[model samples]
Target: MGIVNVTPDSFSDGGRYTDVDAAVEHGMALRRAGADIVDIGGESTRPGAERVDAATETTRVVPVITALAAAGVPISIDTTRATVAAAALEAGATVINDVSGGLADPAMAGVARDAGCPWVLMHWRGHSRDMNKLAVYHDVVAEVRAELLERVDDAVGAGVDPRQIILDPGLGFAKNAEHNWQLTRRLDVFVDLGFPVLFAASRKTYLGRLLADAEGRPRPVDEREAATLATSVLAVAAGAWGVRVHDVRSTADALAVWRASGSPRLKTREN
Candidate 1:
């Protein structure tokens, strides 16, 4: 998966693609660079970010999704609102990458079920505004797994097909740096949950902090590609089904190398 933030305030590459033309071109470029899915998000879910109204969100992403879909590029709508998801689907997006894991909107599950497309349920505690305050976890790995499973159950109980569910640990949504690292280190646990896991540690603040300078300033977003690439390769090695990344070419190239190395099968639950 490749990320295309159509909002003006996403933590990384925000204003760069707000224009429909630029967003579509970028999605096509990512596809050419080997992105299996181009994820377009209209709202900025970055920590401390405020929510955008459904109308604004719809207006921002539908045009880009429609243009990209017209170009034959696979598209995923990265949104939590059911209305937005429905519009994006009608506009040609084939997947729903809900960071709220179906918790934000009561109608999201129904939209997903009716659409019958893949739904990415990311582990989340609350909305971005207060997520940082909710990042209290005793055992990050187990808690994230349990929470994600609950989301899976919610999705399933809402009449969604279990086979269409995908899980994401939500690296920075409500996690501290250490929590992020713990989740990444134990991603195999998520993979073993009998659902395809999506590892999306692309240029996250945790990676920036991990690679901070001696002065304690975090590494810039663009400079975290190397660290992001490492996470992608390691996630694949740990049996993650996919990775959401900013730089499609580098990650695609690295995974290609791993495949050339005879990517060994990792243990996973027999769902």
Candidate 2:
């Protein structure tokens, strides 16, 4: 999956693709770069980011999704609002990657159920504005797995098809750098849940912190692609179904090399 943030305040690549034409072209570029799915998000969920109105989000993403769909590209609506998901699906999105895991909007499950589309349920503690304060966790891995399972139960109970459900650990959403690394190291715990897991650690702050300079300053966003690629390769090697990345081509190339290396453990199941 490749990320297309059509907002002005996303942590990375925000204003870069806010224009409709630019967003659509970037989605096409991602497709050419070997992204299996293009995830279009209108709202900025970066920590401490303010919320955009539903209408605004819908307006920002629908046209881009429509244009991409018209071009026969696989599109995923990255939103927590059911209304936005509904509009994007009507515009040609076949997947809903909800960061709130159905907790943000009560109607999200119904939208996914009715559309029969894949829904990505990410582990989220709260909205981005105050998410950083909610990162406190005892056992990060076990807690995240249990919380994700609870989300799965809720989504299933709400009539979403279990087969269409995908789980995301939501690295850097409300997690500290240590928590993020722990989740990455124990990805199999999520994969073992019998649902396809999406590892979205692309250009996240935690990666930058991990690759901090000698002075302890975090690496810049553009400079973190190497760390992102490492995370993608390791995540896939550990059985992640897919990775949401900013540098799709580099990650794709790395995955191709891993596959060509003839590692049986890298074999993945179709979703």
Candidate 3:
């Protein structure tokens, strides 16, 4: 998957493609770059960011989503708001990438159920405004893993099919740097949920903290390509189903090379 943020304030590459034409073009480019899905986000869920109104978010994402869906790209609407998800799906998004895991808007589970689209429910404690304060976790891995299972229960109870659900461990949402590394090291914990796991660590600040350049300075988002590829390959090795990213072609190429070394060993379910 490749990420296209229509908001003006996403942590990475925001405002660069807020316009529909640019976003649509970028979305198409991702498809050409080997993205199985294109994820569109109109709201900036970057920690500490303020919320965007429904109408604005809808306007930013709907047109681009409509264009991509028309052009035959599988689109995922990145949102936690039911209203936004509904509008995006109606505009032709096939998936819901809800960072809040149905915690931000209680009604999102129903929306996903009715849409019948695959949903990506990320583990989150609270809204962005106060989520950082809620990062307290005793045994972060176990706590997050159990909480994510509870979210699966809630989503299923609200009518979403368990089969259509995927889970993400909300990295950088409420996690401290240490917690983020620990989760990455123990990604298998999330995968054991019996659903596909979408590991989205593209240009995340935690990566910068983990890896630093020659000067002992962490690379900026744009300069973190090598780090991203490192994590991507690691995640795939650990059995991640998919990874959301902004640099589609590089990761795709990197994974291809990694798999070619022993493609048969990579997961390919056979009947």
| TM-score to native of every candidate shown | 0.97, 0.97, 0.94
Worst 10 residues of 1 by lDDT: 262-271
What is the alpha-carbon lDDT of model 2 when measured against the actual structure? 0.93
Show model 3 residue runs off by greater than 4 Å: 213-216, 263-271
lDDT of each residue in 1-271, candidate 3, tens digit only: 8999998998899899988899999999999999999999999988888997999899999999999999999999999889999999999999999998998899999999998889998989887788889889889999989888999999999989999999899888889888888888888777766799998888998788667778878778898888889888878877899999999999999999999887442332223
How are the candidates ranked when ordered by TM-score, highest leading? 2, 1, 3
In order, the Cα lDDT scores of the candidates are: 0.93, 0.93, 0.89
Q: What is the descending lDDT order?
A: 2, 1, 3
- Give each model's clash number: 0, 0, 0
Instruction: Give me the runs in candidate 1 sitting further than 4 Å from their true place.
Output: 263-271
Is candidate 2 or 3 superior in lDDT?
2
User: What tens-digit string does per-residue lDDT give for candidate 1 at 188-213?
Assistant: 78887789999999999988998999
Q: What is the Å distance of residue 214 in model 1 from its true position?
A: 1.4
1 against 3, candidate with superior TM-score? 1
User: Where is model 2 poorest over a 10-residue stretch in terms of lDDT?
Assistant: 262-271
Q: How many clashing residue pairs, candidate 3?
A: 0
